[model samples]
Target: MGSIEDRLRAVEDQLAIADLRGRYCHLLDGRQWPAFIDLFTEDGVFEGLSAVRGRAALTEFFAHRVPAMTEEFWHFCSNGTVVLEGDRASGRISMEYLSVMNGVSYVSAGHYDDEMVKRDGVWRFAARRLTFYFLAPLHEGWAGRPFHNPAA
Candidate 1:
């Protein structure tokens, strides 16, 4: 972070990390297993929908599931904030997931709490936890939010 080369490397790291995230969404949506498996660390964990560990397990998991998901689904991520920590970093990426379930369109807005590591000059996800703010039906919206607790 001091020398010019260091600064450039830092910027490069930032962009690479962002690119990694973009690839994550694209790979998932496109069902590109070979490329997608490379985006995670050997022991990466996904704590969204369910907890999955290791690149092998993740590959196996999505292989069976993704094909069965609705073709109309899309995953859009934005508002990413990444903090550099030498070989490790943490980030939050806001995202919206839209899919048709039972012929009804539903949208879920959330953020991913990410723990990333630079392994062998490549950035990969070590852990990602999806925290949803809301899930709403396209017809009703989130107006009568039932998952909230006004009394508490």
Candidate 2:
């Protein structure tokens, strides 16, 4: 068994990991892709509603998807838990997203299963997988628009 101080250090390390996850969501919401990418390791794999591998893939995915719609979108992440094993860690985060497109709105609620690693005193995401719980569409006009793949 570890000493009390060791346990406390583990708890603190988990908190720091959670804080980094929150910052990632904040940067994404703010459209700061470069800054957001910095949170992940170079070979990171981001898989979720969309699967993006590596920093370059993530950057391309964000560039192609985020700008196609209206700019009114907000993403909130909460209810996260982090588990650490030496230099590697994993976490799950609940996410809520709301967006307005061409005056119409939509919302999605989901959770992200994430894998992280500590390298040279910095924490970075090694992988992330998103699972959606529910999605609700708002406004009637959204149905009229032709379906366009955001990733395209």
Candidate 3:
């Protein structure tokens, strides 16, 4: 068993990881591209359908993509479950992406799966994966497009 000091450090690491994920959602929705790029490790990867490698590439990737929806949407991430091992960790979060189009609200259920690491004493994403379940109008919700990934 680890000592009390080790256990305390683990708890602190977990909190930092949670904060890191929250910042990701905030920066992405706010379209703070520069700050968003800093959220990842220098060699970090963002893996959706394709992969964007490194902070510079990630910046360029989102710069072209995020602004289009900046005024229309934001992400709410919930129920983050994290597993930590020393300076490395992994997490899964349930994301409710809300958007308003033509006065109609639409929501999508998805998962943000992450692999993170602590570098220079700060936690940053090493790799992040996004899997979206469905996009549905508010009235319809996820009833017809339920999320069913056992691995998550």
lDDT of each: 0.82, 0.78, 0.83
lDDT (0-100) at residue 151 of candidate 2?
Answer: 26
At residue 9, give the lDDT of candidate 3: 92
lDDT computed for candidate 2: 0.78
- What TM-scores do the predictions have? 0.88, 0.83, 0.85
Report lDDT (Cα) of residue 15, candidate 2: 78
Candidate 3's residue-wise lDDT over 1-152, tens digit each?
Answer: 69999999999999999899999989888878889899999999998745899988898778875444334778999999999988999989998887775566777878989999998899999999999897767786677775432112
RMSD of 2: 4.0
lDDT ranking from best candidate downward: 3, 1, 2
Per-residue C-alpha lDDT of model 1 across residues 62-134, encoded as one tens digit per residue = 7765555454568899999999989899999999988776677877788999999998999999998988777
Give the Å error, residue 3, model 3.
0.4
Q: Which 10 consecutive residues of model 2 have the lowest summed lDDT?
A: 143-152
